[model samples]
Target chain A: MSHDHDHDDHHHHHDNHFSPMEARVRALETILTQKGLIDPKAIDAIVETYETKIGPRNGARVVAKAWAEPDFADWLKHDATAAIASLGYTGRQGEHMRAVFNDAETHNLVVCTLCSCYPWSVLGLPPVWYKAPAYRSRAVIDPRGVLAEFGVTLPEGRKIRVWDSTAELRYLVVPERPAGTDGLDQEALADLVTRDAMIGTGLALEPEAEA
Target chain B: MSRCETLADSPGLPVSAEGEPVFAEPWQAQAFAMTVRLHEQGVFTWAQWAEVLSREVHRPGRAVDGADYFDCWVTALSSLLSERGVASEAEQSALSDRWARAAEATPHGMPILLDNAG
Candidate 1:
C-alpha cells in the first residue's frame, strides 16, 4: 500500500513522546487515509476482527486439535506452522512456529526480551511481561526462577525450557491439555485454550481437574 | 533492555549501546538498536545483515515510512542465519517454502508481516 497522506510528523516532535513504531503507525494511518487505501470503516473492521474473532479463536483450535489426535500433536510440536495450517486456522506468527510441549518432565515458557515478537495469528498480541526486558533477559537464563516469580512452581528435578520468539520465527508453548478433556470434541476443547495458555504464562484449562 | 529503557522512560530519545545518555531520535535509534540487539543475541552476523539491508537501500521510495524497517530486519535475520551455517540450508529452504505456502492461504496477506511490520 502506498502512504501518500501529508502527515504531520511534527506532531510527534512537540513532545517527543511517541515510540518510533508508534509514530510510524500513526504516520502510516494518515497516509493510508490520503491514498484511500484505508478508511475509518476499514480501521474499525480490522480492529474488530482481531479483537473479537481471530486471535483467541485460532488459539482454541490449536488446543482442541492437539487434544483430539496424538499424531497431530506430535506434528504441532515439531512443526507448528504446517500443523496449524493442516487445521486450516493458521494465523500470523504461527506461520513459522516451534511448539514446545510442557509436561511433568519439562516446562516451556516464552518471552520477547528485545521486542514483543508474538505469534498473533494464533495468540494475538503479547501481554505486558512478554515485552518487558526483565522477563526477556531473565527468562533465558533462569526459567525456573521466572516461573517461581509468576507463582508457578516446577516439579522437583524437572527441567525448564524458555523459547525466545523472533521477528521471523515465533514460538508457542503447548501446555498439556487438562485430562478431563478426553471425550471433548474439537469445538469444546478450543474453549480451554486461553490466551494465557498460549503465552505459556498459565496452564491449560483446568483449575481443580487433577492429572 | 536499553531499547525498552528508551521506549518506556524516554519514549523518543535513543540510548547509546553503553546505556549512555544521548538524544538520538526514536525511530532512527530504535532501528539502529534493534539491529545491534539482534547481533548481540546471535540472531545473525553484522556482515550478513548488511547484505540484506543494502537491498532495501537500493529500492527507491522506502525511507519515508517505517514499513520496510522491521521487514528488512526479519529478512536479514533469516538470511544471516542461512549465510552463516547456523540454520542448515535444508532448514532454511523448508522454512521459506512453508512461509510461502502459508502466505498464499492467508486471507489478509501474510499475517506474519502484520505481526512484525505493523
Candidate 2:
C-alpha cells in the first residue's frame, strides 16, 4: 500500500502553522497590558490559585464531602454548580456543571465528542488524550473497550452510558464511595478521592485490606 | 481566568494579511487542547472523534452562516486548544511579528501567502 498521502495542497496550512488561539491570546495580552487590564496583583492571584490551591486536590475534597454526607451528595446530583460553589471550589467551566453518579448497574463516562467540554472548575483542564479523536470516537461506541485502554476493567453485566458534555453543562462522576472509608473525616475521605475517580475512569482508593 | 476579558476589549483587528483566524476566541484553543490531550491519553478512539466532529461540522445552519469545511476545522482546533492554555496574547504577537519579519526576508516568489481576507 502506497501510504505517501501528501494532499497538502488542499490543506489550509496557514491556519495550522501559527495557531489563531495563540494569536488571540497574544493580542489580548498586548491590549490588556497597554490598557492596564492586568493588575500586577491579579497575575499573582491567578498563578497562586492555579499552582497552590486548585485542580484535582480541590476536586478530591468535593468528592470526599459527597462521600461523607448523603445530603451533600443529593445536592450535588441535583445542582452540581451550587454544590461545588458551596464548597468554594467553583471556577470558569464548573460554573454550571453537572455530576453523573456512576454505579455497578449504570456506569457513566464523559467525553466532548465534538470538543473537550469539561468541568474545569472542578477538575481543571483535561489531560491531552480526552480531546483526541480516538477517545471521542471510541468512547460512545465501545466504552468498555476504551476503558481497557485506560487500564479500567468493569465487572460483567455493568451497562455503560457515555454522556456528551456541552458548554451549558459540565460533568463529574461521583464514583461509588470506596470501602473502608466508612465514617472517615472529610480530609481522609478527600485523600481517597483522586482525579481519576472524579473523572469516573477509576474507583476511589479504598484503605488496604488486612493481611 | 479574566484574560478573555482583556482580549474582548482589545483592538487592531484579529489577524494580519498572511495570518488566518483559526479560532474565534482564545478559550476555544484551550478547549481544543484539552480534547486532544484526552484523546492522546486513550480515553477514546480517533474514529469516535471523527464521527462526532463530522456531525458537528455538518450541523444545520452552520453551512449557511458562511461556515464551511474549513470553519469546522478551525472550530475543531479551537475546541481542542482552548483546554490546554495553548497560547497567550503577548506570545502570539511576538510570533506574528517574527513571521512577518521572516516573510519580508524571504526572496520574492519563494514564500507564498494564502488566506488573504482583504
Candidate 3:
C-alpha cells in the first residue's frame, strides 16, 4: 500500500499495522523503489483496480437485480455476459460469463482444473483455497466430498453439477434467495449475497442475519 | 490481454482454462500483478520473465517439485534484480531475514513489527 509521495496513504495503513504478508510486500516495494525498478503509484493503481473496480459486490448487484426482477433472472440464465455487462461489470476475466442457479433439485460448483480461471470483474481475485491444488483437483474428481468439506450438504435427492471453466468462459453461482426476503429491496438483497455463495461454496446470509 | 502472455509463457504456470486471472494468495496476486505491470512498464519482456522463471524452477536448492509457481516467480524476480544491479543478494536476503525475525518474534495473531531501528 505504498504511495511514494502520499503521506495520507502511510497514515491510513498505519492505523494498527500492516499484516505479515503486507509487511513482506512492503519490504520488497521499498527496495524496488529505491532501485528505481518500480513505482509505488503503479502498485497503488493495481491495488485500486481490484479494491474498487472488481469485487464480489459487483456479482451481488447482479444477483440482487436478478432476484428482484424475474425477467432479469431469465436474462441472466440466457445471456449472462450481456446481462452482467449491462451493469458495467465487463472487463478482463469477465468477458464471457454464465450464471448457474442453485436449487433444491440441483447444486452447482465451479472449478478450473487446468488453471485458476475466475471472474475477476465480479468476484475480484480468487481466494487462496480456490486456487490450491486440493480444491482444484477435488472440485472435479469428488465434488460432493468437496462441498461436504465446505459444510454444504445438498439434499439426498439433489444432484451436483461441477463446471470446469476453461480459459474463455466463467461461471457464477446464484444462490437461492432465502425465505423471508420477500420485502427486501435490491440493495438489501445484495447485502445477503456472500462471496462464497457466488462461488457455490456457501449459502447467502439469512434475511435476519443483519439483525 | 497481454497479461495472459506471461501466464501462458511458463510451462507449468496456470493458464486460463476458461476463467480470469487468479492469485491463490494475496502474495501470489501481488506477485502476479507485479510481473504483469512490470512487463507492461517495460521492466522485462514476457519472454525474459518466463525464461528466468523456468530457470529458477530448475535451480538447485529450491523446491523444484512443489507447485508454488509464485515462489518461482519471486526467486526469479530477485535474481533478475540482482543481476541487473537493481539490488544485490545481500540486500534482498537481509530484508527477508528482518521480516522473518519480526514475524517469528511477533505474538501469534499479532501484527509483525520489524525491530530494524531497535
Candidate 4:
C-alpha cells in the first residue's frame, strides 16, 4: 500500500542549509529529475515518510508505554502486532510486530542478515551499523563482542538473545526502564528511551541524562 | 531468549504484515526514492532495472562489502541511465567531477556554489 496522505502540520522548514551529504543528495535529485529519471514529488513523499512519519519517537512511545503498564507490556510480548497497531502506528512495512523484553538474565538484540528489514512504523529507519555486513554477520556469531563495540557492556552470566528479523516478522526491543524514574510519567519516560536503547545497543538513559 | 520466530510474508498487494527495507543514511533514501520514482515514470521497467542492478553488483572487480548496497544501487542506476540512452556516460562522469572540484574548493559552512548550476 502507498503511504497514507494525512500531510498534517509537517514543518517544511527552509533554512537554506544543506550538509555535505544533503548537498550530494540535492545534486543527485537535480541531476536525476532534470534527466527525467525520477519525479521530485515521489522523492518528497519518501523523504517525508522517514523524516517525520516513522522514527525513534514512535518506538520511544511504545517503550514508554510498556514501562508504564505491566499489562500493556504483557500485550507487547504476547501479541505485539495488535499491541503496536492499537497505538495507531500502523502502515506499510510495519504491520507485523514482535517485541522482546530485557530482563536481569536475558538481553535481546535485533539484526537482519539477509537484508535490513526493520519496523519502519516504530523505529523509522535503522542506524547505518545495523545494515552493515559486519553487524548482520557478527550479531549472530558474536553478539557480546558487537554489543561491546557499541559501548554496551552486559553483565557477566547474562545471556544475549539475538533476533534475526526478516520481511515477514519484525522486532522492537523493549529496553528495561532505568532506575531513579519513580515519579516520571509516560511522556517523561519516553524522553529517556533512545533509539539505540530500543535496538538493544544501549540502555534506557540515566534519569540525570534527561534534559 | 532466542531468535524470534520467522514468519512467511502474507500474500497480498506487497503491503504484507512485515516492514520494508529501512535506509540508514539520507542519501540511501534519496537514491532509493529516485530509483522507485523513475521506475514508476516508465524511464525503465522494474525488470530491466533489476537485471542491470544484479549485473552491477555482480560486475567484475566490485567490492565484496555489503555496506555498499545503496552505493551499488546508485551505480546501477547510473549504468541503466547510460545504457538506456537517457544520459551519457561521459556527461555523468563530467558532472560528478565538477561537483567534486566545487566541493573541494568551497569553504566550510558555506554553500557549494557551482558556476554552471542551474
Candidate 5:
C-alpha cells in the first residue's frame, strides 16, 4: 500500500515549521509506515486511547471502590494486577501492579528514580512532575520535602514511604479516605480522588471540599 | 494557566494544571504512541523497550531535568528498530534527511509529506 498521504492530517499546523526532533520522529514514522511494520491509524488510536479513554478517572474509580468495599481493598492490597484488571482497567505500563495504601500513620509516595514507569492503565499518563528529574531524585532523597512542594504536609510523626516504580512493577498510592465521605457513594468518592492523589502528591478531597 | 506559566511557577518541578494536556508537546505524545504501538504489534517486547529506554535515560551527560526525555525516547526507538532489523540506522538517517528536505520544501500551512522531498 502506498504510504503517501496516510499521515497528512497528523501534521501539526506550525506554519510549516518542524523542530529537529519533530522531523526525526516524522521520518522514522514514515519509514516504519512504508515498511508496513506499523500503521499510522494504530498510532493515532493508541494516542487517542491514552489522551481520552485512559486516565486518572479509572484509577479514581478503583480507589473509590477499594474505600467502599473491604474485600476489594484486601484484593488490591494483595494482588493489584488482578484486582485492578477486574475493574476493567488493564493495559501497558500497568501490567504488574501494587497498591500502596495511605493511612493515618503511614503515607505512601511513588517515584520512578530510573525513568517514569507510572501506572498508565489506572492513573493515566504521569504528570510532568512525576517525570521531572528534580522530582524523581528528590522524591527518594527527601520524600517529605517533595511532598511539601506539592503542598502536601503530613503530621511530623507520620511515617512517609517512597515506592520506586520500575518497568516490572508499578505502584498506585491509594490516598487515605477523606473524613465525612462515608455517606458518599463510589461515584462521588471517585470525584474526590484527584490524579495526584493516586500518585501520592496530593490528598483526596474532603467531603466538604468537594461539596 | 498556560504551559509557560506553569513552567515559570515551578521551574524545578513543573506541576501541570488540573486538566492540562497529558503531554507538553504533540510530538512527545506521538513518539510515545509510536513506541507503544510498535510493542503492541509485536515488533518489540515491552521488556526490550524498557531496557533500551532505561539505558537511554541513564546515559551520561543527559539532561538531569528530563527535558531531553523524548529525545532519549527517539534514540532508544531507533536503536531498537535497528537491533530488531526493522530499520537500520543508515536507513533511518537517510529517511530523516529526506524528511528534513521535505519539510523545507513544503509551503507554510501545508502538511509535510514524504513526496515533497522529490
Candidate 6:
C-alpha cells in the first residue's frame, strides 16, 4: 500500500527527500516569506504553539475545574466562552464556546459536519477522525455507532446529542467524571481526562487506570 | 485491538503512540500554520477561511477520508490570495516552479535554497 511504502521510506530516509506535497509547501513558504507576506519565524511560532504548547491538556484542566467546582460548572454551562477565557484559553476557532456536559441520561458529542470547526483554544486541533467525512457525516446520524467504533458503548436508554460546530461557535464536551474520585484534586483529576474524552469519543480514565 | 489495527480499519485516521492525532507529514502542518498565520495577519477573516475551506472540502470527487485536506487547504489559500489581491495566481505559480528547480538542484541533506534555482 502507498501508506506502508511512505511509512517505510520515512523510517529509512529521515527527511532526505521531499514528497510532492512537501515540496509544494516548502515552495509556498519560501515565496510568501520572500514577499514579506508571512514571516518564517511567525510560521514556526504558530506551528510550535499547536504542536507543543496548545493541546487537550488545556481542555483537561477546564474539565477538571468543572468537576471540582460547581460554580465553574454552572458558568461553563451558561457562558462557556467567558468561563473558558477566564482560564486564559481564548483565541481563534474558540471565540464562541459551549460546554456540553454528559449526564446520567444524556451524552454529548461534538462534530463539524460542514468542516472541522473545533474549540482550538481549549482542546487544540481536531483529531484526524474528527475531520474525516465518515465521522462528520455519521456523527449526527449514528452517533452511537461512531462511539462504539471508538470503544464507547453507552447504555441503551441513554440519549446521545451530537453538536455540530460552526465557524461562529464551537463545542467542548465535559465528560462525566469517573466514579470514586472524590478525594482527588483538580490537578490530579486533569490527568485522567484524555483528548477523546473531551470529544466524547471515549471516557475519562478510571482513577485506578491512571495508576 | 492495537492502535495501529484500529487506525488501519478506519482509513486516513492515524494517531500517535499517545493516541493523539498527528500530521502525517510536516508539510501538512506547515500548510495549516500558514492559513492560521495569514488569518491572524488579517489577510482574510476566519469566516472567509472557513467558507473557502468548507467549499473545498465539500467539492465533488474529493477524498472522503480527508487525506486531501491540506491539499484543499493550499488550494483554498491560493484562491483567497488571488481574490484578496495578496498575490496573483501567476506570481505564486512562477515562484512554485522556481522552488521546484531549486529543490532539484540542491544536494541531498542540504537546505533547498531558492538561490540554487538561479
TM-score, first chain, each model: 0.68, 0.71, 0.72, 0.74, 0.74, 0.74
- Model 1 CAPRI rating: incorrect
Q: Mind giving the per-residue lDDT tens digits that candidate 1 earns over A102-190?
A: 88898778776433345656775444345456776777777777777876776699787777665556777777878766677788777
Please state the error at residue A44 of candidate 6 in Å. 18
Model 6 bad stretches (over 4 Å):
A1-55, A114-116, B1-28, B31-118
The CAPRI class of candidate 3 is incorrect
> Model 6 over residues B1-118: C-alpha lDDT tens digits?
1223323432233355665445544466678778767766677876677778778878999987887877777787788888998778788777777766776565442445678779
Looking at model 4, residue A111 earns an lDDT score of: 78
Q: Summarize candidate 3's per-residue lDDT along B34-110 as a digit string, tens digits.
A: 66676787777777777888897877776555555667777787787677676787887778667655654543223
DockQ per candidate, 2 decimals: 0.02, 0.04, 0.08, 0.09, 0.17, 0.13
* lDDT at residue A192 of model 2 (Cα atoms): 74
Best by DockQ: 5
DockQ of 6: 0.13
What's the true lDDT of residue B83 in model 4?
A: 89
lDDT for A160 (candidate 6): 94
Poorly placed runs, candidate 5 (over 4 Å)? A1-55, A113-116, B1-118
Order candidates by lDDT, high to low. Answer: 5, 6, 3, 4, 2, 1
Residue B15 shift from truth in candidate 1, angstroms: 39
Residue lDDT tens for model 3, A153-199: 87798888888665467899999999999999999999899878898
Residue-level lDDT tens digits of model 2 in B31-92: 33333434554544455555455655767777555424444544443343332344443454
Say which candidate scores most in lDDT. 5
Better of 3 and 4 by lDDT: 3
**iRMSD for each candidate structure, in the order shown:** 17.6, 14.2, 10.9, 11.3, 11.5, 11.9
Which should have the higher lDDT, number 1 or number 2? 2
